[model samples]
Target: MGIEIEQKILGHARDAHPHECCGLLLGRGGRIEQIRPAANVHREPATHFEIDPQALLDAHRAARDGGPQVLGYYHSHPTTLPEPSATDRARAAGDGSIWAIVGEGRVTWWRDEKDGFAPLPYALRDG
Candidate 1:
């Protein structure tokens, strides 16, 4: 992930404080090149998030047209740790996508594997 990208994630989290902010992580391979912020359409935004379906569709379409790939998803945990919550685990599709959770002044990455979410380590780089 780029340092700027990380900053944007943190900033988004801060801006949406008390309500979960969500977005798509766009890039190729292992680098996150951009973040496409989306509306959280969940009924209970304060503790949960649901990225707007239209946003997901548009991202996939863009990727097919040679735009940045949808590398993963990101969301903020308003009052919890950066780790995945029970609700997150229950909703995960086990699709092997990267997930970035932000909270308490930090961000943590995880891989949604078939079995479960595994902690992932990432290094920030300058663009």
Candidate 2:
């Protein structure tokens, strides 16, 4: 992940303070190159986050059109630690995609594994 990307994620989190923000990460080979902010359509956005379905669709379509791969998804915790909550685990599909959680002035990455979300180490590239 580039430091710039990480900062953007945090900025989104701050902009949505008191509510959970959500978005998609576009990149390749374990590096995030872009951040796409998606509308949080969850009924209770303060505690839950549901990325707008259309955003997901557009991402896939762009991939088919030679855009960056759907590297992963990102969301904020609002008041909790920058880690996946139980709800996150339940919603995960175990597809081994990256998951970035932003909160508490930090951004953490995880790998959605078949068993669970494993913490992922990342290096920030100068941007």
Give per-model TM-scores. 0.97, 0.97
User: What lDDT would each prediction earn against the true structure?
Assistant: 0.94, 0.93
In terms of lDDT, model 1 sits at 0.94
- Candidate 2 at residue 38, lDDT? 94
Task: Supply the global lDDT for candidate 2.
Answer: 0.93
Clashing pairs in 2: none
Clashes of each: 0, 0
Candidate 2 positional error at 70, Å? 0.6
How displaced is residue 7 in candidate 2, in Å? 0.3
Candidate 1's C-alpha runs over 4 A off are none
Candidate 2 lDDT by residue in tens digits, 11-76:
999999899999999987667899999999999999999999999999999988988889899999
**In model 1, what lDDT does residue 124 have?**
88
